[model samples]
Target chain A: MSEVKSKIKRVSALKQRGKVLRDTNPLLAVFQWGCNHMMNEAELVSDQPLILDRDFKAFSKVQVHNQYYNEQELPNKFKVKEYCPVVFKSLRHRFGEDPADYLTSICDGQIYGGKSTGKGGGDIYYTHDHRLVIKTLAKEEVASFHHTFKQYYSYIVECDGDTLLARYLGMYRITVHEKETYMVVMNSIRPVGIPTHRLYDLKGSKVDRKASDKERAKDLPCLKDIDFEEAQERLYLGGDTETFKETLKRDVQFLEKHNLMDYSLLVAIHDCNEQTPGEIDRDVDVYHVGPHAKDLKADPKRLYFIGIIDVLTVYSTRKRAAHAAKTAKHGARAEISTVKPDQYAKRLLEFVSSMLA
Target chain B: MSEVKSKIKRVSALKQRGKVLRDTNPLLAVFQWGCNHMMNEAELVSDQPLILDRDFKAFSKVQVHNQYYNEQELPNKFKVKEYCPVVFKSLRHRFGEDPADYLTSICDGQIYGGKSTGKGGGDIYYTHDHRLVIKTLAKEEVASFHHTFKQYYSYIVECDGDTLLARYLGMYRITVHEKETYMVVMNSIRPVGIPTHRLYDLKGSKVDRKASDKERAKDLPCLKDIDFEEAQERLYLGGDTETFKETLKRDVQFLEKHNLMDYSLLVAIHDCNEQTPGEIDRDVDVYHVGPHAKDLKADPKRLYFIGIIDVLTVYSTRKRAAHAAKTAKHGARAEISTVKPDQYAKRLLEFVSSMLA
Candidate 1:
């Protein structure tokens, strides 16, 4: 017994000991762990693969299976497949991010955004810092992203950061308990440190155009069509409306060309007291939006952050049937959440431009 | 919104979800993670390095400084080093264990044995299966292990596991938060799933040879010399005394040769109602003890798990000084848990063999 005591004494005297932290929960902790695991694996992939034409149709998938013994904290196994990994890695760099920092920001930290799974059923996750949004995508959406990934890359390159479309950073397939979850990460509509007083997901539709009572109760409700109409919120491009509208038209034209539909302008409004006209121009990518008008007084302190989101859907024969079916339910004359690609593009442009002040 | 709903509908129809478990805690979980990490790294160590004469005196160290990321679950970093990795890896094989299974059983499952850090100030850990004991070694003890490791390996080879000495498996140096902890793993005295009704750590000295009332309150308290003597127990080696005594003698002589002291015979009595002759031989490692003679008809089923533990101490100059200081306090013939190596070995063998049953 005294010998046991002596051994303990020596252990206490152990030099330069490391700390061990308790996990938040098993699932979240394992997710963080898996991020480390996959990132390490990703390091093995040949760096900067030549961007080939066929790379658009390619997907890099990684599967992990733990057969026996690791059942304590982890189950028998899991699989994580990254879609078009090379493209995404390139996209990461194009967005001015380092892979290591990106992994840390996404996978490390307090993990705050577990907003209730919306009516759509798939979960949406926002990183603690609000710099990233991890949104669940359907298998069809993943296929659609792969379908357009090459052209999408070309468009971003042509215009640099001027496009208004949701910038696709990375996509993944995580299988837990054998259920596959397709997720895509993109930049949040607003800057991380900025405070947003209001936000909206505008589809320019009239029917079912307001936030539900529950959605309205949220701290920053993603309000919709009639809600925006009633609030009379307008896009103020200052005097640079032509340039901003050109980027929007080109972005929408790309979606329309691909027969895509049902995307929206995701908008966040940050109200700051120190609203100098050029404050935003100095801070954000000036190419993203039109410049502030020299004539307008900087009386009300507000800055707008907007980007197009939810553009993965492509109109096919199946969507034609949906268009016909939705027309029957919502009526032919009224604007609905779903429509044909050309009609959706025309209606979105007219509705958005009509809001310019 | 409809598109999002449709995707959700599709996501719901997808199949084969796997479970993600919550971690037990941060530290223990990280230990599990680090095990996976180090084992993967171990794959790179060249196999069967030439066992040089001086190899027994060496160590293999790894220092990890993760400057970015993994700060939540792990510290910004950690270090893990193996003591004579090649020797231990070979030792693992010599003990009839596969490295994979060993790693799985140890690093995968929920860790179970966190023995109270005794007065000696080190914690003892066991795998959930209880087949192995992870004990913390002092800096001095680690040095002493290096001193005697070569001879220990030779002794095990000579006897072919037919002795009472504890089997050494592997040694490690782990640093978390800069603190260094020295650990060594060995075979447990009691086989997994075996029930020991009473156990005693026997040193053969009587200066303080009784279990405290607190110790007696334990389900299987480790009683001492006076307790054993008061109970009036005797050997029941079933007429195999000749073989058992020889093994014991060989083990003690080896200890005496090393000039070590303060070792103890960890004895456990598994009192059962289904004791059948030769049952132990059918189940346990037969070489560990001599078989019971077929004549005995004791009905109560029991299995005694006996082995030597705490054999790391050497009669170095510091130990000699402690011996002199203790001799002055308890008097020259007090047998105060510290004695000359030959005297300690002779006394321990006599006491342990006298109790075999």
Candidate 2:
């Protein structure tokens, strides 16, 4: 009788544990499921020496059924669409990310930070290790991504994944309960272990480009171009200046050619002097040492991690309308952010160049 | 401002809805995940003309990593092992189950009935549509299944899935949070649409064979051989009597040859007269018209659906000891259920034969 009682107790306890693990957010659950399964499946296919035109358009869609006992916490039915798996796999390879490690970082543990919303109304999340960022995308943004992904892939290939643009690892469209969520996974700009003392989103615009009071009240506010200029901030790259400028110019040219605008140069500054001893995880925070760190002019106080983000937005009719409105409001020569792609790229390069010491 | 507030409200509402769907039971979730994934994958492979010896031992294992945000309600890590995919696929094909329909049935909807516990301490679940039963298995039972699966597959092939034995659909071993749960999916013996008026688990034994008071108190208790004897029940097969007897003898002989014992003939009686109009779903309740329903001796009042279950148990040393203990307690000639396979099968046949009218 006692054994039976204990057995029943154990069973109920296990059941209770299962109840706790039930996925309350099935959209995220299915996204993870899709990534894990698709990545594993993608890994099984041997690497192709040359990228095919068809690869850019390749997508895998799966409809999942979670009926009856199986429908734990997830919707009884849902769908996941993975876009450009082969291209993303190639991008991940070019970016020097081990597929297994990337998978582990993205899908092996709990991801944090869905509370923070992006400017595009998409939720932003970070992997527990902070090596990657998963940003939800609006449907139009997903359309924009699909529109420019081929050129994006080509650029990444040409640059050998060394440019400042966000390193896209994967993209997926998850549909749960008839609602669709587009998400893109990319390498985080900030180093995983380092504490950023200051961050800025620089688009070379002076008109209404300051961070909001609400944003300024945060522990680490993402300031704007005006904030950077007011603070008299400058990056002391020493001998790496020319290489950085060349890469920046080339990336800007690529974006300009594609008629893309409204992108920001995301900069994160780590005050090395303020960091505690052994606070850095070198393995995870690979960006801590800049390219040509050894050639730096003995300014040991700070390190910077930077990347270009929000590059998916094109200078389409929607942006042209916004550009016209901003021009009228702030005057045609107000250095407004929503300029044409050519003017946007030129002003951004000049502003960024002035910040180099 | 109102628009922003409404958007926030909508987002919060979606999040709340997601919270409701969160899976608390990771074990069942993973089981469902594994089944849904593996079955879909199996369907993609073209059918093999012949089953090789290697196919019998073939299995697939997947290790899932659910780190950070991806971890949601699932454990950070878990593993799923699918055993004998090819053999099971073959078995399913032979059993006249459409692979696509089977997948949809198991994974597309909510599976019900994890509350009922089988005698082996395993939880029994029914598919939402009641076409299948999913039973959790002990590790030993998994081993026992593996031991006899080759013969089982061969027997299934020889009989062409026409035997009265329980139809085994799929088997899986799911490991979550370091705990392992083995599960088997099979066709439910009882008809789906028709309500069973009485159910019996007849093992042809007089000792300790009756349903307990607690079991009898249930809405539909699984009565035993003693209860059946007490009720003086009989099956009137009429023109189908000889054919039914032949099938029973053949099935018993097969079990005996394999050293299997302690199996039960599960009987469910559906009273047509007591059933509500339109209650019977002919499509789902395929068994309503038994194999020889037309020749069922002019019995318009009742329909019987019967099958052999618990056939995985083998007459090993453990069972031999139980047989000896029971024989000593009840005297050598007693019709004990725990006897050697040959004796057990003979006695079961004799008892079943006596019920034929």
* Candidate whose lDDT is highest: 2
Candidate 2's docking class is incorrect
Residue lDDT tens for model 2, A72-158: 334656777778777888888887777666766755555566655345577887765778888888778788888898899898878
Score chain B of each candidate by TM-score: 0.81, 0.87
Error of 1 at A117 (Å): 6.1
Candidate 1 local lDDT, A1-357, one digit each (tens): 221111000011101101111233333433443454445534433445467664454444433333222233343355555566567767777777655666656554544554443444456766556677778777777777777777788887787766778777777676677777777888766765446677878887887778889888776787887898999887675766777678789989999998788788877776666444445553453234321111122214566777888777777666788778888997887677678888899898898899877
lDDT of each residue in B1-357, candidate 2, tens digit only: 001110000001000001111245667656665776676546434457988787767776656543221233345567777788778888887777766556656644555666453456777776656678888887777888888888888988898766888788899888898998888988777765568899999988887899999889878888999999899888877677787788888889999999888889998887778889677654455444433121233355777788898788777877778778888899998877778889889889999988876
lDDT agreement with native, every candidate: 0.62, 0.71
lDDT per residue (tens digit) for residues B17-85 in model 1: 111112333334435444545454334334544455544654444333332222333443555566665
